[model samples]
Target: MPTPIQRVSERIAFAARTAFDRLPPEMVVSAFGVQYGHLSTAEGGDLFVTRLGWPMLDRLLPSQWYADGWYASHGSQLKGSTGNVYRVASRPAGGKSLDLVVKFSRMAQEVPLEVSTGFPDNVPPEVIANARFNSPMEEFGLVMELRGGGAAPELPRMLTQKPLAIYVPPETYQLWELGRSRSRFENHGHMLSRDQEHATKAIELDIRRMYVLVYGWIKGLDAEDAAEDAGLDAADLERLTVEVIAEMHERGFRVLDNKPKHFIVRPLRRGGGLLHREGALVYGLVDYELLQRTTEHQEAFWSRRRQIYRDLFRRRDEPSPASSATHLRPGRVFGVDYLYAETPDGGRVWTVGRNPGLFDYFLASRWHRTPRTKLSPRNEVYATRTRDGIDIVYRKSNVGVRPRADPFERRGRQIREHGYNSPFETVAIAEALRRKGIAATVPLAITRTGHHSGTARFLHDARRFRVHEPFRTPGAPAEPILIPDFDYYTLWASFGCSGQEAGATVDLETARARELLDDAEFKALAGQSRADLVALGIAGVPIANHEFLLSTDAAGRLERDARGKTRVALAMDALTAFEYQVLKEDRYQDLLRRISGQLGTLGVQKLDFSGNDVLVLLGLDGEFLAGPDGEISGTLCSFELMRGFEGLIGEPPEGVPGI
Candidate 1:
């Protein structure tokens, strides 16, 4: 990487001590744009310079790299922390140019609408979508444009605020430092007399001049944005801090190292009256190499920040005493943490948890019918928008419930991962059901084991019971039979819908239709649904197998008759033609037989190979029952049977056992 300085040898000499000393200053005097001048140095050190971008960036060419001023924060960036930030100007080119702090981690990036996961790097969108990081530094590069104005202070680490390190050229050791200032003068009674005169001097400056000039590590940045850069107001700044905490908790991150000095607040934007600085305010958490991936960061941050805030506020000389959670009120917020429940497919009933912010929301809500509840993003009308998508039980239901407990405290009581509480629990349940000669199966397990017996990520059912919510309405069903979501839980999601939302919708709708089949059309749909389910191999169900199917419809036609009266007609799609065929052809044999015969009758008939009716069947037999069988896998019963066993009365089987 060549420096912007002119003569190449001079550029190298500036970074050296010996051999290059003989070169003429003119040859060494490289003109690196306007701000950078070529010069020589002693030993070892870091170099900082700005330049225009390529065709030949060294020789400015037509490009989109026009930036007012951008800065680079020195040191390393951490996952979840607010800390000391270092800044210096970088060339105005397009590689992750953010005006605010950028986080680094394995955040799945999207190109247009395709889900692509990769490291943070500078490249065109199309190029970046397919990029990957080699190490931390490369993956964590952030270039933030400074906020407008100089009134607000930016967190050196966060706002590309640079540390003041005196660079003495090549091979020379650079010295960095820490500086302190007081607001005692301007904040009369606000600043503790750290030094009355010094504080007063700081206050004497124009209100705009009332700045705290601190000293520290890192170095240089001539970055600035003209119009949009303004500081945030004090109030808004505080809220931003809280929101930062919220994001950390929701993302399953824990801020390990935090100190007052580690925080850097920069004001690149204008002022926002008195509440907050004008432009967007950024709070960067620095020194995060010690971070852990637990959900405990909330407490750690609050405990540490409170003491720091308290000390800072008290130093202002205000006698008002206070604590944290000032923004949290009871009636305004509510939340729910899922406990444990069977999934849609009933595979692994995983036990997850609630993040800290949501925990706060749960504690703040008024008593609701559900045991627990919380305020979440409004778009959470479906799958949660958060990292864990932790659900808070707030809506009232048929289950009798009690008051919700505070999630912060409740998380302690939960099993990190519940054992038998998942869909896999069905293993035992299925065994028990099968022993009774009932046609039961573990279809989900089979679904997980692909047709070729491969592994699948959709191991758990749609509703994993990490946290199970009981029905809220007094007495309801004895068991909370969560609807199974075949699309997500089976070996399908990857090849199924686009995401959890679409997957959930399909499952819910199908489940509802299956549950509400007292009507004729629904009866047919339910029959097929059952058969389709069974053929998937969750045998031991009462529905008839696809092996035998019946079609039915309510009678009514536009036939011209003497009486000329007509009534509504009901129609049915044979359980076998669609349901049975789909399964026999697909891989769901357990599902095939289980859903047949369940269709409630209208005008019923049996179809032949050509799809013509060969016989009239009696209305459905009582719902099918699993017959006793040792080697068979699916239900062995009949729901709609040809009424006249009379037609084949002479053909008695030789193996008819005495029953």
Candidate 2:
């Protein structure tokens, strides 16, 4: 037990951290290793404060609410129907006393029959099914959010008691006594694992433990009590209640059991009339255990927030006050600097770069749920334009899975030699190739959902686990953290979707499917692509037709010479280009042979190759420009599977299929 002097000293220390009038950012602390991983540092332990409220640390300390503090309360107000709630006033030496409502948190308990049945008829089934009780932290968090994070002053603030703090005593109780399940506790642990890297603090509840929520009391009477004292009839009370409910819903919040008793109304003079703000009844909302955002509002909020995040990301390097508007922080994983944050759905995101502002632009909520066009049938890949109008293609990573192979197949032989590369490896290889004068699709970000992979769990792939050991946790000894309990998405900039290039690119597979080329022409184009890779020193993996995207004119037409032969060329950049005119069979074969002979001298191997792997540039008139080489050139788009000299293999003409 803390002595009186020690308690006072602790409160003073806590209050010292806050500026005199300005509120500090909401923060979380861990207790007994029941960590709020996303929001807290190792130094702060087991506490969560709402950012929407002014944190009166001295008034919020446990010493002001329990044991000696309880005995010192001036008096207790009438108890509410829910039980375990008490309103009291506590005074510190030489300081004005604070009126507070302290309640035992009912988190993890089943919703009572009356409370569950009290929801509006139109309430969503999903919301009703999950409407039990909010953990002390959740209740305060929702309150803060409703208060508009205290950062935005243009919006009208919600009228509610300021959430002070959640205090979890350093004590435990039996499960039966607490009516909480250990399974729920473990579930929180899983959520912690997914978002532990987030820097914002949130409260996480534990099983078999007591949580106390402290709130600043509003000086008013419930609508029912005030109306009666003011000689208003039941009809007036009902009207007031309905108005409050509607107001809350309009603000994107709703209470499951919205009753007149939950609305606190101040009396104007000796219970004669109720107070009003600008001709509207002023009411303070209370009881937020079942508070939630309406489905429509929730969707719109996320969309708007995602847009703001992307805007921040674009100017991340520039100085601005808006940088702190969204939830983002610096994170490092697998030797790559990423802007990291948690999605509203509890998933994790890591945008590959230094700009934290760019983190929200990659959130799955922004694109994954939007209408997307399937880019491939064999792989789980799709292209979608984000709410911000940026086109991106995202694919699930097969990092920890082995490839299916048969010894007789050419592609199988290559698959046996190298496995799929992780998203980190993909971006790293892309950057490396770009530095070596290869143009590739821009690798943007990666997202890991909270759900586990159903198939990968049954398979054995030790190599990926071993290679990614260091990424299990930053600064920790290599542990096998690359387990299969997650589905990772690798996001990339869509080829030919940047400024002035939108829809001006066509992959070879699409071209062939669309009959833009005859059988002989398609075959020659595929062969030319193979020869191009050979000259560039890409070996081992068989390049696929769909992986190569060629630039086209604004009208999506290929450049043709006077003889009606398609003029195919690779544009390296502003200063370089490679032109390859359609040639006769014998001439094309000679060029292919010459390029194939240079494989050993160049010595580069790609673990995987597809149309998505390379990009061709074009001049303003859609014609291929001539580079220094004046032959063929393109950018490497997919490189997660590319390898360096150490892992290079010689070109084998016999085993590679479709080449």
Candidate 3:
């Protein structure tokens, strides 16, 4: 009765399943990312299994889901409000036998009335209202955490089912068939976002897809059944339940629908004695869909973690006993590449460039917490030499801030037009300009500060929330996933530093203020730089005097012209060793006129272009290093708002042709 295509498909599926079985399982899981393999089943299903689950993975194949010897769980507690659960026992020929507890995932479904109404009367109203079942992935992740996935002395290890795998069958069903609530599904994004700690956006549940969770079965009976078999008094069983719940609470976990039925207990071989440890009954906890941390515990945990981060920041140069290098991985955002990792305190760092060595240098604890000189009084920007002796400038990002209520201010107006660029955008723009032969500061990294921002309530800016809405960790907690509630920090290589010496680099504004260059000289250089950038098709550049950094030689002495004028050096000719600098005085009038004319011909405007954004370089003996067409050397040092305009200008030749 099968069509030819169906028959061929079945054969192909069988071959794929056979090949999957032949592949060696990867046993060791690294601390960084998920290490797993996708498995295709003969019954047209998919399985994602961890290294720990790899041993018994074959038993999880969809074809054997309902095979002989698997029976529905009929305990009193399993009879109501939970997903379809079954106990499966398999003894394969010449292989290790497996006992699995297979349950269909009930993600996105409302808590059954019976379950919701069972919450203790003392429980918070909000907790009861928001209770729902966990997705398969979430349940597994939580179970791993409970089982000491990242064990610490303070956290007590709790016995629980070993999460083997998550499987999805080939068949699909309508939402109604799965008893999914449309209202809950539609409104789930924010809640899911709140629950997850992912890098981006809120998680969404696929109502049409059925997800199943498979766990290694614990050979035990529920508390009630076990107590009946053990002939324990009611008071003893009640005391056991209370003690177990308290221990789990101390370990930062809670089950909203807590009941004795959820706990599994096993008896000893000899006299049918119950398992005990340290004068207390030992039991395994199960059914974790409603698992969560208590509020007081979560707060204390984060507070302690914040202190640890501060300590780490102070001693960054010293070898860390808990090096997080293993967790670092290659990541790219926009056009820039980064070696990124989540910090021990729950913060994240995205170190720019491809080198893994640069990752630790930009960690917030390495620089932000160090003693530093304020670089900008108006902003929380500072210049600090890291414990490793690398100079860097770090500034708090204002992506989600509104500076003033006075709508007339430049910052306010700018915020209205375009939300301040996120740290990722800032670094991406800087990197792009560098690739295009434009001189700009080196962006070191971006940090998501682990501390709660708490600044969103005072400001009216919704930009950060909207911008980061797409990057959310699924099934984290609602508090940690509120991206807008956390502050962001961006790091940049100090532009003024040359090697270990500081103050070797000075911006045009400081130079002018220090009388290194007179008023007319400064204005002329700034104007020419703006004209050159506009000619190159970049507009809206912030080129004010402070934005232009001028470099000094190793001894921190400025290069000078024959006439005793401080010279700003640009670049050196490889063949001639002659350096180029912007023309001095009215000598640049002709070149400036030409560049301005080119800007006009290209029909572009200097929106935010100013003298502060320019840089100049002088040749040997302060002589001019002119191009073939007598072009002057002018470069950009700032690109916060720089944008590439359309048309007119051709790409610069290989060497930029002396521009």
Candidate 4:
């Protein structure tokens, strides 16, 4: 450790440097097989590398190393957090000149939990062929294809089809400032234990730093609002915000995170300026890993409400209700209908949401909605019970953020045992899965519960009941739909744990699933599950000696092809992080074994889990109706399998099955 005076000097120097850059490099943090050094370079002064693991560096750098000068190689070191962030640099193999920025993250894991060194067996070939909440999607079996240097207009089109962009968030910025403040406090407080002044001073400085932008943002927008009337103007803003939200939601995308860091206020034109005051300013949102096809509106509303209260009210015990969406209905804004979609090539389309009106509306609604709270300061009330039958209220903070007084106390964050959604863990797992011959498509989207409220069981119920095959359908084939009495595949995925803390295969007990099930939607779905399963032929029988840990809840989403056939599209959404780890470990494999054993007992010697590893699997019921064509199971080949599949068939793979 540096001496007291030296430390103080270092702190001062660090602060001066960081005043300009996003990351300040004055300290060294060592972990894994590497070490990182932070300092300012002449290029873009104030920028710093917060952390860099050696093995990671060695893998990233073009050469062994160089001095404080810049180079010309393209490289980066990712912290592997939920932020798909990377401290990037471009250096020539033997030249000068470098460019650096903290790149964003679309996916992250806790390093060790899910290690995907390579592919598994032939996995699915689709974008989300076979996915797992804990394991990587078995679609990345294909090598990553990078696209750059293309004309600007094509960028958006290509991006949506097959592009991944990362971003930094305001929280990271806040955390860094928090650390700086804490350091300042500790330095002064070390000698003057009762020096509240020192701590307050540091905190005040940080608060000012963090909020200057918020205040300016609000003030600037308020000025804009002054030009319009509340009735029509407010309605217009609300409609714009909701419309933009609807477009993004329908496309199935989520922004970088909760803040302005990953986004920008840019001109609508290609030649935009910095002031954001000129023509066609819009929210140029960045980052993709956080994107999701399905996110509840309430979560987003609550998040915005929390920010409004924290920033606008400054924790002054103000009961502001306007900070959040007054609307209760879930629709377009809640789901990004305008931002993402699947392409003909099965890639992705992500640029649909980057428009001017969208950003303007986003800022307007977020800045102005500061409603008054109903409760008294230091008072508490019972949490809400939703119509979906979910009573999963865990947070205590009634502030816009938690809607309660404190979240830690009620202990609602059950699955959050490690990394705030580990991006590192997933990276490794995805890599490993690829090595194992699986085609794992990574997440462009992530889900958030009310506490992460998922209607998983309901989705299951809906799907299972949609095509329930009662025992005696007059002309049904010998093996119809999913036979409940003898054999059935528990098509599901895992959620919660991380690669760093738990292996990808950690198992979550029912207690935890119970916690996840606390979600209103799942609870209501569970209410209908028993009757549906009974109708489907599994109410009393032992198919594969297995009782569904996830008894299907009926919300009826399973879709059969429009063709006059039994062919259908099934999405198996199962497993929380805990369950994924369990499967990654002994139990999941064991569960597979138990199921297989039960199948043997049923005199069925054949089985097919032969594809890539996944949180869930999609299969067409071919046992009777042509028993899933080759495209069903054969349609999926993990990265490992995809490559090898071609060699085996001496030809490229096929496409979607049936209608």
For model 2, where is the 10-residue window of minimal lDDT?
34-43
Clash counts for the predictions, in order? 119, 18, 27, 154
lDDT per residue for candidate 4 within 386-418, as digits (tens), equals 221111111121111112213375322321211
Structural similarity to truth (TM-score) of each candidate: 0.20, 0.56, 0.48, 0.22
Best by lDDT: 2
Worst 10 residues of 3 by lDDT: 572-581
Local accuracy by lDDT, each model: 0.25, 0.58, 0.57, 0.25
Which ten-residue region of model 4 has the weakest summed lDDT? 211-220
Q: Is candidate 1 or candidate 2 better by TM-score?
A: 2
TM-score of 1: 0.20
Ranked by lDDT, the better of candidates 2 and 3 is 2
List all candidate RMSDs to the true structure.
28.3, 14.1, 19.8, 26.5
Q: Cα deviation of 402 in candidate 4 (Å)?
A: 50
Q: Per-residue lDDT for 1-659 in model 3, tens only?
A: 98765764564454345443454433222211233445555466656675557655555555444333243422112453366876766545236557777788777787863444434323577787788776666667667766762223355577898887777776789988988877766555444433333323222346677877777887788888877668777787767766776777666677877777788898776687798888767788888888776764454344334334333433333432345455556555554566667775668777665555456657665666566877444567776756454556787877677544346876446535654556766676666555654445667778897778666466646764564454333223322222676788888765533221234555555455445667898887677656654554435745444444465555545666587555443232221121112244355544445433444544532333444334334432344445466665444433343333223222322322211
Candidate 4: residue 506 Cα off by (Å):
24
Candidate 3 segments whose C-alpha is farther than 4 A from its true place = 1-36, 66-81, 91-93, 113-122, 149-153, 186-205, 304-308, 315-659
- Residues 569-646 of candidate 1 have per-residue lDDT tens digits of 111122332343422334233334232232112121111111111111111221221235321124311111112211
